[model samples]
Target: MTNYLIDNAGVLIGPVEFPVVPGLGVEIPSNAVRLTQPLEHAKPGHVWVMVDGLPEERVDYRGVVYRTDNGKSLLWREVAELPNTVTAKAWPGTHYYWTGDDWELDQSALAAEKKAQVLLERDTLMQHAQLRIAPLHYAEQLQLITQDEQTALLGWMRYCVELNRLEQSPEFPMNMEWPVPPTVGTP
Candidate 1:
């Protein structure tokens, strides 16, 4: 069994000895074998942002604005194009605006339309949430079921396990050993 050294405060801390070369500073214990496989990377554009608010909570025409990591307001325009007829409205003190074609409103009808739109938007969001949870359900099934479903379930389980291990120890080395220094005098 390989024993690895872990530095408490230095560059390499908490090192464990393993057959494989620890890619990063920390080492892996040789006895600790991988139990599961790694998860595959989600396809490009797989992730979607889910906002926590109602349509009324959303400013009309303005869509939504997000603060960028740079401390600037990444207005909706960054993710989508803006429409014409821009006007700002203050809601509960926070100003929101519409930058799109104005619609002539029959007050009551407009209210009903807004209500319907909110419901539709909520439904769509719920569907997206379901899709995101499906893979997790499959993984849970892998953990529970046996016999017939074992093989298929194991694949997903492995993927999840691998992904978690990778996250915990991203520095696990691919190669097992380092090259030895050549003897200077001996042939």
Candidate 2:
């Protein structure tokens, strides 16, 4: 009932339904091959091949991910187990890097991305610190602030200075020691 047209490599071109030739019954195409027991529909991602003069079914994994030595795309099973190939999910921003033999996380790139995020966080903390410091500095200049207010102002200033010095720490952006803001009501 169903015949498949295939290329020389046995890759399926399309399915064909032949008309009855009256006395001859069905007129199958010369280039078409059919399974011994043909199914109504062919399975997806399957290849039909002539093995030992009979049609055989095999998997077609041309869509599988395979990368060349320089990270260019290529078909899977084309160069499988080859020394210069890296096979892994090639999705964007996954941070997967090819080493000489295997895939690994690119530490330097990861650190750089994390550093940028940390810098943004530091800038935000500094902006919030400045908001608290500006009014206190003005109060001190007018001599209208109490002793408790002076101590609070000094604590906030020290916190600000610590925040500025965060980059000087040996851990820096990678494993930073964030400066805690002074408590509002505590001495």
Candidate 3:
């Protein structure tokens, strides 16, 4: 007969084989239980649990396959599934948090991110518009600007103004209606 040593929580600690004296009955500890089939060595992240007096394998995060003499038997618990969030998987530029029971959007963080993106786009557009207007403005002061150059300068200036006014819109950082930028060198 094969006897398995178990703890108070029924975790299989080790095995005590029978017939230690060849023909004599084995001396088993109080925590040992006899089993019809021999138990194999438990794998990592798994434990041999005694469910209703029957040995069964269960998932154990603690990796408590076997314990030393001074080690304590840990209670087996069923791990609950994690709640699904709006962003199901982790990726770059994505943020999510757990709100006690469910995953919720961090609105403030999203707003801040959106605001930064909008500001970056606006700065780029403003710089482009300013560059296009500089030579045209100087040419106009010298009376050397053509009508097409004057028209292009006005369109670029208007685009810059629109870009600056973007932050004043009601949607602001959340939803922005970006103004159409003028063509590179035409009105």
lDDT for position 134 in model 2 = 81
* Most accurate candidate by TM-score: 2
Candidate 2: segments with Cα more than 4 A from true spot: 1-22, 34-59, 64-88, 92-94, 185-187
lDDT of each: 0.34, 0.68, 0.69
Tens-digit per-residue lDDT, 6-116, candidate 1:
222111112233455566764545333221222233334221111331111122233333322112233343222233322222221122222232223344555455546
List, residue by residue over 39-71, the lDDT tens digit for candidate 3: 887776577878887888875543221122112
* TM-score of every prediction relative to native: 0.21, 0.62, 0.56
lDDT of 3 at 113: 90
Ranking by TM-score: 2, 3, 1
Q: Order candidates by lDDT, high to low.
A: 3, 2, 1
Question: Which ranges in model 3 have alpha carbons more than 4 Å from their true place?
Answer: 1-93, 184-187
The 10-residue segment with the lowest total lDDT in model 1: 48-57
